[model samples]
Target: MTHSERWCWYSLLLMLIWLPIPLGSHRMWSWSIFEIWISCQTLLLSASLWHQFPWQKIRKFVWLLAPLSLFQCWIAIQAIPLPVEVLSIIAPDVAQVYRQVGADVGSLSYDRYATLTGLMKGIAYTLFAFNAVVLIHSVKRVKTVLYALVISGTFQSFYGVLTVLLNSHQSWFFGLPQGHRATGTFLYFNHFANYLVMCLCLGIGLIVSQLHQTESGSWHVRIRRWFSAVMSAKMMIRLCLIVMVIALIMTRSRMGNAVFFSVIACGGVIALCFYKRRPRALTALIISMMIIDTFLVGTLFGIDKVKQRIEATSIETETRDQAVQWSLDIIRDYPLTGTGLGSFYSTFPHYTHYNIGYYNYAHNDYVQFAAEAGIPAVVLLSLPILVALWFCFNVIRTRHSKTLKGTALGCLMGILAMMAQISVDFHLQAPANAVTFILILVLSGCVRQIQVRPESHPVAVDHLLLKN
Candidate 1:
């Protein structure tokens, strides 16, 4: 690797180490550390890789997502109106308090919590822009970074499982607290579960790719050896996957459970379709995943509150339904330009008398984005996934490397899974999820480029190539 590539790899390792720090501790210095590292990396790239920035190539992709960012910025400055019909229903005393608070604090009284969260979201978007630039400029460095992410992510899975088994509740040096929730570094169990799901997807990709390579060997003897390795890796990956699923169930997060299984199923179908040449094997893989998932769900969680929570989809609770309705009203009032970046709660009482203390966000990412940034922001934010899907389709169709092919499919499936989850919960709103999403997008982009690039020279494949 070149000097720049080496530096990038080291920087990524640091990021992985920083990722699990709890957000509430004095030692929670990972955020600033990563910010500094990324800033420096950006400077280095600007100075050395100026000519190879791939601006034209990546501009198309960036432009697809830029409108959302700009729209969010625009909405962050506007004031949204609450519907008169809804406002009429508020009790006189509550209405008086709402008006007084609104008039006194303006933005502060309305969205005290969102002030910090909105700023964080802005920072995340900036980081995402930087990540995109880095990804387009240096494919090799991006690949190395992604590989490091996979390794660290696997370790995190193990850590999460251990945390569950030990039932530990101590806070980590990074300020992350352990509790009944499965929060690693993030304070919220839901956010932690989302992060785990993404990492699990990456692990699945790595394991499957390895198995395929081992199975497709040259001679009968080699094929036998490859098959053995493939089986072993597959078993190990399944074990890890089971642990991850159990963790998700334990989180008691309805959205997380739904997303977890949905991704696995969607990913299997996609894999089967891509491997149409081996229809029987593909079918068997799908069946096996279904069977394993069903058995694991029954065995690990049993039939109880956790299982019930996972199965319960409708807003059965009145409070939750009210919150959802209030969110809808906010979106309707600010259809084009939202109240402000973090002003949803501030503006919510004007729509309904639902107690604001119980709610922080809309509990839905798309609604949150629309309510905070407006419709345009929502569209802009969704561009990456659409572009990624198109890119994955092309890569899967044209790529020769089985590893690349599986990765393309896996990344696509993972993104889709996360998107499905986002429809019900605001996982992407948190730093942990944002960080993981950006990493996945960067990795997917790199994999696509590697697969499509012309092969004029001989390839030097890794010795740790995927067997199967």
Candidate 2:
């Protein structure tokens, strides 16, 4: 970490911490600032790392970004003005609207301004991921960023808990009263829960990265190892994880909680079935998280509320199902080119059911994305996540470094969790959550680029083995 590189990464860290603070950065002003800040960071980082750009390692990841780049290009095309005749051939509906107003020019997008803003956000997120990959080049730096994420999450958890404990009716930075739901700095409970879930995954991975693969040595040695773990920095991280879990439960987000526990179960199964030498520490950590977090901490918090919400969920009770059904009409109408990025709100009104109220999002990310950007765009956006998941699996299956493997496992679970949650709610609509989700996916693909070398410290070397 040279001085310039240090400046780049630290600035990025500050951005990540700042993102969720201003109502998840969903407000136009906040996200505008976010884009400007990341753009500057990208420029600074690019200039500093121009001498050694790690082109060899970056080339391996280019294919993973192809679909994303195409998606952005597609959005840009939608925002561009075109003659009405060209628009009619591509998007008849858009052309019909222009013809109704006796206009000779139009674009595929129903709302070009919204589409352009969406394009800017898309580029910002892409640049942010690039900065992360290029700046976090080593295992130590990776650990540092992960720790910072956990620390930021812990602060959110603590603040959310404190607000609930005070029995405050008013939400933070908003007039709506959240009651018992813990929303942290975010206005929405589910978004906050989703953010915490990602942080918890990273914290758990950091712990796994530090754990010895297989327990060995005499009774005294094993006991010492256990004691050291209980009294180490990992213990503090564990505490943070617990706080986050408590906050998650307090949020009372049905799908958010369900996706998290389900992903944890899936991760444990994959590890046991695939890893040749299953680390005792890995199993213990999983068991503790499942039991301690869900049972003990949850019992103390409001896990029952979360369970009740899940049990009470049904098509009849939820309006989002209706929204999703109506959104399909938009997809049907614009199957080829879509209404355009960020055009869902405007386009959905035409198909909205009588029972459905005004909704900015379809509440299902997949449906909203398809409705807004067309089916092809949905596939394009999904490609990077699917490829990143493959990368995570490869790292976990083949990498000798426990740290890398653990990080991969965490990223895999986090991505899966987000995917599951997005099927029911548009967590990705929030800029902060979207950015964090992209970071997790980017980090997963970056595991191969991490240089794993033996350290002088016996414990450090024991935890992160030399790469084969």
Candidate 3:
């Protein structure tokens, strides 16, 4: 690799390592700074290497998203109140802290928590887009980027296991004010678990690819030699998967568990559908068995917690309802340009008389987006997902290379899982969650490229011929 490639890889590695640092009040600020710096450096390196932007296939995608990101930034700066502001205008007593803060229109409210989160989200999106542009230029660079992700994920899995084992409860280190919740290196456990899930999926893909490569070379005299190595590697990966699964479970996050199981089921179905060409009936049977075993294990060892979670679904429902109500109120009042970004919390309390003390976010990503950046932002945000789904469907229909097919299916599953989770949780708003989402986007892009690139056909054919 060139020095630029090495630097990109190392920088990604550093960001991953820093992901779980428990940075407290400085978490958002610190991550924003790191992302901006890395993105700028990547842009410089990319410009030097290619002398122009690369990957014109998705230029439309980039252009479509830029306005929404810029609008988010504009909203954050304006911090306007929605029609809900009228409640505070009339009653004043019903207004929450944020509305009260915004009521003083003469001066901007720089003290609100939402302000900080909004700023972070804007910066994070900008950095993510820049890095994504850099990644699109070279397939090799994309692989290195994925390697960095895998390394980071492995680190997160290890850290999560250790945190659980040690029962570490402190929020942040040094003099930073501790967050009130268990965030690990973020502001919440669910966000951390979301990051882990993204890593887990990528790690699984890497391990599968490695196994496939090893097996393809061992049909003759070297069969036993390669078989042992492959089995050993598979065993190690299985152990790691177990650790990640356990950590995800221990998080007690319903959305996390839901997304995790959804990915597993979806991935398995896609694998059986497209890749299992031999003993097809047996493949179906085995897949059924695996799903049953997964459920059985969860029931036997994870029953009580599962029951508790089921019961707690009511709480989640209530929270989501209130957020939806607040979002609708904001949208109804300002249908064209709802409350500016970072202004939801500042505007939410005016619509509801009940006390929702200390809750800064809408808890549902769609609702948050609609409320913060208006309906236009929500439409733009869904573009990548829509494109990814289209690509995934094409891959399945074509039954392309097993690796590309599997990776595409995995990315599709990941996106579905995340979308399902977002209905009840604002996973996209948190830095860790946002980062994971960006990684998934890149993975989807890579899978799409693999399917379309002319070079990939020969590469797969060569491997198959060599195996035969």
Candidate 4:
């Protein structure tokens, strides 16, 4: 890697390290510790670009970013001031309701301040993703980032477990929410669980790749080699994996746990099918891991609590259904532009017929995106995800580098789990969870970039080393 690329990786490494702490410098959950890190790293990354802007570096992944760019730009557009007459067509629901009440719906965003906040967050997300794609230029760099992510996740998981063990709900950390549930450094347990889910995917992929042969045939040497592998890297990673799973179970989040194990099952199946060697061993390992972890270890960590939550969900009022209806109501009025980005917090109340306290998020990412940015936002947001997943499907189907293929498989599972969880919770609203999502996407892109190269390219590394 070039010196600039090296620096980019360093900046990225530090950014991921600092992202999980509960330091909210800005109130919107938009400007937090993670955001601050993103800003600093973006500056460093941009400086590298100013010296040598590697257009060629990003060209392969450039087309993939079109929907995201449009999505971000459209968010900024929502903040611009327009006459209420113009808005009647753009944000009909907010305007019609205001007209019915003989109140003026401001020409700017439905709530200009909120939209301004959303705009900042949208821009930050874009810059952050851009930096990731540019800086993480190789498979090795991607692996290093994943390793850092696992370590960071392990630290967060450990802290969460400790908090739950101590039962520290009395004092909120940094005035952020803390409770019996292990929230880690995030404001909510669900967000923490989602973050851990990504870590679990990476750990599983790494572990799966490790179940292979070594050539030294002496019995003592082979035993030592296996012992060293178990004692050093693989065992440590598996230990972290166990910690995260326990923390996740302690979270008592029904969808979070369900989505995670489901992803694991599916990812494992794909890995088995794609991986030509040791299919039996891989299948056995995955099944044993699931049975031992979910049914065995998880029961010790309150799996019944998760089961109760799942059961209780069926009895509760379909609140998200109502939220979706109201969101649709918003879309009908402003079919073109909707209520404006981040306006859901302020706009949803006016349309709500049921008594609910502060529906800040629709609790459904898709509904919230449509409510805030209009139906087009859904297409804009989903196109990139769909395209990325298509690439991942190809990667998982094709036989290639085990490390890269495993990385792609893990990322695919991570994205699927997030999607499943978001049906009931807004995991992506948290900067920590959102950053993890972007990181996965970036890794998939890098894996694809390398996979497309001719076989003449350097042989794929058997191990993930940071300093190659």
Candidate 5:
């Protein structure tokens, strides 16, 4: 990597590390700072590498990114003031509000300031993902990113676990009493669990990259390979995975825990059934993850609490379900053009019938996005994930490089987990989780675009090449 590229890479690592520190950067001020930081990084990197920009690679994902671009444009449109006639034609409710207040002009957005802030943050996230793709031009860089995520997750896991063990109720930075829940630095347990799920996926992918092919060999050869693994650096990642899993269980988040285990099971099944040359080591890794992480470590770390939460959850008891109903009302009223991006808080109250508490977010990302940006915007947001999922699936089915396949599997599982979890929670609303989700999406789509070199053994490829 060039000096500038190296700095850019470090900048991404710094961003990843800093994101979850300040309540998942969900606060306006925290997110704004990172937005400026990432935008500056993008500008500087583009200035330094404009001549050698990877246009060819970026072009490959044009179809995937086109909708996102349009969605951003849509957000901008929501924030832009339009003539009264134009506003009336597009979003009559917004225009009606203006007229009732004796104003002739207004934006589609009910809260223009919130929409603009959302737009700025959205742009920063887009550029960060773009910069990540541009900088990660090699398998070595991919591993570096994965390791950085694992390390960050491990730190969060350790901190959260330690806080609970110390009987501390307050977060070190946010001063929120977590009440035995391991939220780390994040304000919400669900978002922290979601973040860990993504990190675990990447860490598990790293382990898969380290898996030796299950060829017919003598017992001595198998034993030697197994012993080498026991002594290898993979143990650190394995330990990290364990720590994160423990923290995940401590969160007692029903969907978060469910999605993590579900992804592992589904990913394993897919690999066994679909991978072109599935390795036995891969099967072993998956089995170990399910058996050790879920049964053993989980047993010791409040898995029962998560199960209790799941079993005890009911529609009547849960107010979020009611909130979703009200959110659906908003979506129903504004199907074509939503109330506006970041307008859920402002728009939800008028439709809310019952006491669902003072909910700023709809608690369901799908519902919230639909309520804020309309059904079409929801489609635009989901399109890239669907496209990226296909890319990762193909990588698993067709690629020979273990690192590529592992990364693909990680991206695949992470994306699926996020998709599943977002059904009832707004984890993606947290900027940290959102950016991490985007990075995984980028990795899934871009992994296939990068080429690989010939290697004697697929298992040894990443390690040897990275070392060299």
Candidate 6:
């Protein structure tokens, strides 16, 4: 990597740690702290990468860009000024809002302002993901990013678990509401759980990859290996995984808990299938994960509440049911042109039946995305996960190193977990979780770095995976 590239990588790490602070850098009402900071950070990195931009590297991941650009294109269509008569048919709910104010509702979308803001936020996130793909170009940097993710996630989970154990209602560090759940630095427990779930997936891969527990000789060797508390990479990853699981349990989020364990299970299966050479070690890893996760974390965190929450699921909560119904109506009325991005908070209120309270989030990302950006946006977003899965499985089958393959498979599971969790909660909407989500994507989608020989210099793959 070049000198400038090193600084850019450092900047990326700082941003990862920084995004969760200051109320999770959420509340982007009117140019909030995250908005200003993210904009500057994104632009600077984008400019630096512009000169020696990894077009070859980036184009290989065009599966991501296609849907992203399509979503933005849908946003652009929403911004255009259209004839009122035409819009009334395409976006009647939006027209109704404008008509309610005696303004030319039919001439424009009610969500134009929100669409612009949402598009800007999406752009910033994409830029940061690209930066990671460019800078994290070697095994060393890749390991650094993964460990950074695990370490930062562990710190937040530790704080969250600490606060919960003390029965505090707000953070000792940020003074943010604790809400009876382990939210850590995030505003919602689900979001904190979301962040930790990804970390846990990574931790599992790291632990498996770093595991040197091979049965070679006698029972004494095996016994010593099992009991040793060495401060090695494997041990740290294992430790981080344990704490993150415990903290996730503390969050008491039903979907969060369910999605994480399910994904972890799937990850274990992937490891066994692909890491066939390490059958014994992988089996031990799986057994250890299961024992630690169930007996230790679940037992201590009082998993009953979450279990009951999951089993007692009805049609839906009153607020969420109402929100989903209203969102559907909004989508139906504006099938072609969405009400606009970021309009869920403003538009859902008009369509609410019970007026239980204000709902900024639609609680379901799918419902909200479809309502805000139309069904096409939902389609655009959904297909990328499939593409991601394909990319991950390709790496598993093609990559030479066991660690690189495990990391890719782990990221695929993490993305799956995120998708499942997002079905019930808007965790990805949070700045911290979203940035982490993108970083994981970069890791999963990365081909060049993983394909390079490990013994080569960091920049050896600067031109890998591209045809001249």
lDDT of 2 by residue, 1-468 (tens): 568778988898898899999988988999999999999888887788789877876676675556667888999999999999998888888899999999898998888999999999998888887787777778877788789889889999998998999998876566667678899989789999999999988887888888877554456556768788889998998999999999999999888888888888999888877754457778888999899988999999979888888889887878988889888888888887888888888878889658567888888999988877889888877888888888888888888787788888889889988988899888888999999988897788778677777534554443444221
What is candidate 3's CA lDDT for residue 301?
40
Colliding pairs, model 4: 92-333, 93-333
Candidate that would win on TM-score: 5
Steric overlap count per candidate: 16, 0, 0, 2, 0, 0
Question: Candidate 4, overall lDDT?
Answer: 0.73
Model 3 poorest 10 in a row by lDDT: 103-112
Candidate 4 structure, TM-score to reference = 0.88
Q: Show the colliding residue pairs in model 6.
A: none
lDDT of 4 by residue, 1-468 (tens): 567657767877877767667531224553644556667777776776786787876777775566668887887777776656776776565566557767654543577787877777767777788888887766667678778988988888888888889877643457544677887777777888888898888777766655552343355544655676777887887888888899999888777899899998888777776654333346766886799889988979899988987777742555776777777787776666767777788878888997856688888887787777888778778776777777777776764566666677778888888889887777777766777788788777777777434332221232222124
Model 3 per-residue lDDT tens digits across residues 125-147 = 66665565554445454444555
Cα lDDT of all candidates, in order?
Answer: 0.59, 0.84, 0.58, 0.73, 0.86, 0.73
Ten residues in sequence with the least summed lDDT for candidate 2: 459-468
Model 4, residue 416: C-alpha shift (Å): 0.6
Error of 6 at 90 (Å): 6.1
Q: Please give the lDDT score at residue 128 for candidate 3.
A: 62
Worst 10 residues of 1 by lDDT: 455-464
Query: In model 2, what lDDT does residue 410 have?
Result: 86
Candidate 3: how large is its RMSD?
A: 6.1
